[model samples]
Target: MSDPKLQEKIIDALKTVQDPDLHKDIVSLGFVKNLNMEGGNVKFDVELTTPACPVKEQLRTECETKVKAIDGVVQVEVNMTAVVRSTEHAQPILTGVKNIIAVASGKGGVGKSTVSTNLAIALSLTGARVGLMDADIYGPSIPQMMGIPISSPKVGSENKFFPHEKYGLKVVSAAFLTKQGQPLMLRGPMLGGIIQQFLQNVEWGELDYLIIDLPPGTGDVQLTLTQKAPISGAVVVTTPQEISLIDADKGVKMFQ
Candidate 1:
């Protein structure tokens, strides 16, 4: 005879499990799908928001542990799958890119680019395909920090510029085209045009994460990128200061 009471116990256990990102129990969020219990073996599948989720393994382990603690449950099985969601403004050029994360700051000299560079390196170290785009046209520094040979992007078919590769990262920076310490001298419209080319013309194939180091402050480049690119999210870097906090608030509001 089947024990209906045991099924309730299994579900109750799952209710206690929460996703770190969503901060809600997986069961209530409808992540625990197609659950079935046969004898003492409980089997189910977990559909994550994205395959690039950093804590996917942790969630799976928690689910297994919670369900296996049930008195009558002997074996627990979980199948993992990912469904990547897209923004309404997603562009075709970024079709293969799984996630576009922009690192910005309220003002300059706040180490925004440094944070973006190191974050990309850290993600690459984890065996993920990572790319870094220095969106700071007037003061692009990723080329120097990454030690990439100063060279122009090579043109691929369909007028796409191939991204420069270094340290297992695909990188694109305006510094590659202009000499060190040279000024861009471009107006706002021109700056927006350049940023668009970087997004639409760069051949960044199938990256797990594209880390964009946006120029500090809420400016033309930031506004252009936000409007033209399907940015999955933003990271605002700010030091402990009153002025920086105020500027950081503007950055946050721009996204909202």
Candidate 2:
């Protein structure tokens, strides 16, 4: 039997575990699940965003160390898994943005949006001129996720559109243009064209970094951006889950 105080201490220790990419505590993000105790031996799940994560071993060690440090804890077992990205999440489209960095994942609900948003905020907090593009045309959520209102951009010369501003960050997304609750009925070629226009025609002005939140999976939009623009690099986001890591590996390959 485990002491109640020991379990509380273990949980408290885990509160210090941070998802390095997302800049949020792992416990708050629901990454630490299923804490079981048996005679001072503890077993828990350390769910991650991607399985192919370079930090897997480090995180596992950190989790173990944190759990073991608690008084009365004898052993620690961390069962790792990856979280998937959800289709309902929207991808942001950036315009006139330079140094594009696509945040991608093999599966949905892996906290890709959370990573993108926090990264943009962190970059901006560092005084870099930043913009976020929601490239997930089918499901756009940058507006809501970032707490920005949905409004159409103003048209300028040559019928170019201007990006909306939020927290000193410029942003553009499908959610900003469509009517509330309307379906986006677009095919591959059409969707690609729209993303192209958002990149080429929008008045993003000058920006140091443009972070793109890509939709889950390998699709036309992702290919279009890679081929159409000069991307600096790609960041793969995944939970420590096997299935998510398997898919994230494919995403890394797609970029390579």
Candidate 3:
């Protein structure tokens, strides 16, 4: 059903296209998938590491150009897709979530929630399964920022609850659990307990990226979350000022 020599030629041509980030050829990275051939027609999928890859289109174009250059190739079909790589967690919590990203800062007013909201939406726009959690107990603002109505997550059997689905993100927020305009008079211990509860009780199923907007500061909220869950990575936001950077440094150190 296929010509051996022609297949070899196609493979060789594809080897010239290297992934800018990984610095490896598509063939070597095993990005080429579902390759099918019929006489002069060649069709294949270019599976990438992340859906939001910066050079997705460039890689697709390069793949098409190289395949079309093959002598016997009369037609070329290259589809770009992504499968996000995940980090290994010691604990089996959030088993279905592939990546858990934390958005943090040293102090308030640094726009941590703003970054988290946009980052989660941006990843979702790339066609990846994404979730957003507002871990800021004292001042939960993700609901308003995401335009998500304040509502409780759906409770399932056995103390589990499903996160609210909106804007292509499975969202959970502290604001959803309390009355509007009411201050959270929670003590230090309660803060950590809530974080653990959110991590263990909420049902965030099969997400490529679960972005958690951590409350500003290196306090109970931060400690509770980091200890209870495996953070794949963190993005610490801050301003150029010395005061802001000092707190940002502390936030970064907390994750380390």
Candidate 4:
């Protein structure tokens, strides 16, 4: 037989569970729903903001831990569900993407592209659907580092391009579109247009993380991406030198 007072203790326990992404407790966020208990058995559902949430497992574990800590709890079941929340400026081209993270650096020598490529690959290794876009039109190096042969993207319906794959990471880069050793000789407007096409015309389907490697320093390409795309966050890579820190500050401010 279940004591009515145990339900109060269970509810109190759930209040301690937090959803890191939402920055709120699961109970306060209304995630602790359909809670039913009989004897020492308890079950409930934790609805998340997205199916591809990076921290979904963490939240689930915390919820179970909190409930199982209740004095009368013998069995705990946590059901998970997702209802993806859309941004106000969400575009049709990025419908399937759950999150976008831009990797930038203060200067060219910094390992921004290397970090971007490996981050995408690491995420993919974790069973996440990941995509990497080389926004460094003038010095795209992801294809070379990933050892993907230079080739153009295939066109699909509505003229969208399908991204290339290497090591389970989906990739799109200006290097693939340009001839070897050819410089991207163009003005700011032309460069912006090309960046737009790279983002909007690529058929990136159902990705957990879309990592964009921006060109070194904050310039026309960076401006175009920040203004035109729905960037969720930015990762500024910098060296220990004061100069690098100074420029990295600028990159951070640009995103802010």
Candidate 5:
């Protein structure tokens, strides 16, 4: 026979464990799923919002430790899984993308693209589906950095572009669309149009996060993204130098 009172004790014990990010217990956040109890053997799954959560193992360990300490509990099994959540009721403009993170800089030479590249890769290492979009039209460097050949993305039906696949990431950049060493004498409106094309017409498929490497400084690409897309967050890259810090300040305020 199942002991309802014992199960209640297990739940209460779990309630003591709180999600550091959500500032609430997992039970209150509806993270505990598929809980099963058989005599003293207890098993359950903890579903997190993002696979890239920094404290994933910590939560799993806490769940196991707490449940095992309960009286009459012989074994405790906790499975960790993730389902990336969107920002509130905001429907993503990118069909299957759950979150869009923009990486920008106040000026050039601050390594914004490099930081963005590593950020996408780090997220992918955590088992999250990640994509990188190089929005730096004038000097697209992600292709060279990522070793992606300068070639246009493959087109699908309805004029949708299939982003280039490289290093477990779906990548897209203007370098693929233009000739090598070609000077793009594009105006502000044209720049905005290009960004919109990349955002709406790319077949990014299902992604937990899409990292956009914006051009150095606030420009057409930044304006288009901020005005059109629901950006979840922004990162400003800069150097320790005062000049770099000054530009980075502008980038931060632009996003804010």
Candidate 6:
């Protein structure tokens, strides 16, 4: 016979489990799809908001532990599946920009943004029209690194802000929207939305290359850009350190 008491305990324990990115309890967030208990063997399904979730393993482990702590549960099994958010399927708003290239690094502090900014400038200076998109929503250092003051884009009658021009390269970033020295607290879905707006809504006005400075790690932003946009290719940057190389491999596989 099934143990209703044990199942109740399992559900109560799951209340403490939260999605790392959304910062909401998994049960309330509706991630727990279904729970089945057959002869002390428990199985459950977890639906994630993004396919590139970095904490999938962590979540699985947490679920297992919570269920196992129940009195009658002998073993636990979890099946995780990613369901793309509704907004992610919406049509892109920048069709003018071309040749999107994601510049990524296995780890931070590898000068990936430096390479991206200089490359955009160099491409523009060489007479090929260029645009640089600082997609690093968490730590947007492009505006400062490129010496552009943190300022908002001028809203036009059409409700689109013209991109800021620097070194002949059109630039856009979340830093431009935020007040100076303010924190950008954004979740994965929000970050993906911002990137989409930067690409589709911004009036880049014809370009040979649109270089995207992706945040370090293999996460939602990287996955969204490549899947949403017609990404031509990606460039992986890393130091001589072996640890960096391991992360670099993960980054490359994210594209493949």
Question: Considering every candidate listed, which one attains the maximal lDDT?
Answer: 5
**Which pairs clash (backbone N, Cα, C closer than 3 Å) in model 3?**
none
> Candidate 3 on 1-256: residue-level lDDT in tens?
8898998888888899999889999999999888889999999999998999999899888888888988889999899989998889888888988889999999899889999999999999999999999999989999899888876677898879888888989899998887776677899999988898888888887889999998889899888778888899999999999999998998889989
TM-score of each: 0.76, 0.62, 0.97, 0.80, 0.95, 0.63
Q: Candidate 5: where are CA atoms >4 Å away?
A: 89-92
Clashing pairs in 6: 93-200, 94-199, 94-200
The global Cα lDDT (0 to 1) of model 1 is 0.87
* Better by lDDT, candidate 6 or 4: 4
**Tens digits of per-residue lDDT for model 4, 89-189:** 54555878878899999788889998998888887776678899998988899988999888878999999899999999889999988777777677778
True-vs-predicted CA distance for residue 14, candidate 5, Å: 0.2
lDDT of 1 by residue, 211-256 (tens): 9999988889998988888888899999899999999988888888
- lDDT by residue (143-254, candidate 2, tens digit) is 8888887767899999998888889998989887788778788878898898888788888887767889999999999899888766777999999989999999999998
At residue 223, give the lDDT of candidate 5.
Answer: 93
Window of ten residues with lowest summed lDDT in model 5: 86-95
Q: Please identify which of the two predictions, 4 or 6, would achieve the higher TM-score against the true structure.
A: 4
Q: What is the C-alpha local distance difference test score of each model?
A: 0.87, 0.82, 0.90, 0.85, 0.91, 0.82
lDDT over C-alpha atoms for residue 10 of model 1: 84
- Following a full C-alpha superposition, what root-mean-square deviation does model 2 have from the true structure? 14.1
**Sort by lDDT, best first: what order?**
5, 3, 1, 4, 6, 2
What is the lDDT for 215 in model 6? 95
| lDDT for model 5 | 0.91
Name the top TM-score candidate. Answer: 3
Model 5 lDDT, residue 182, Cα? 76
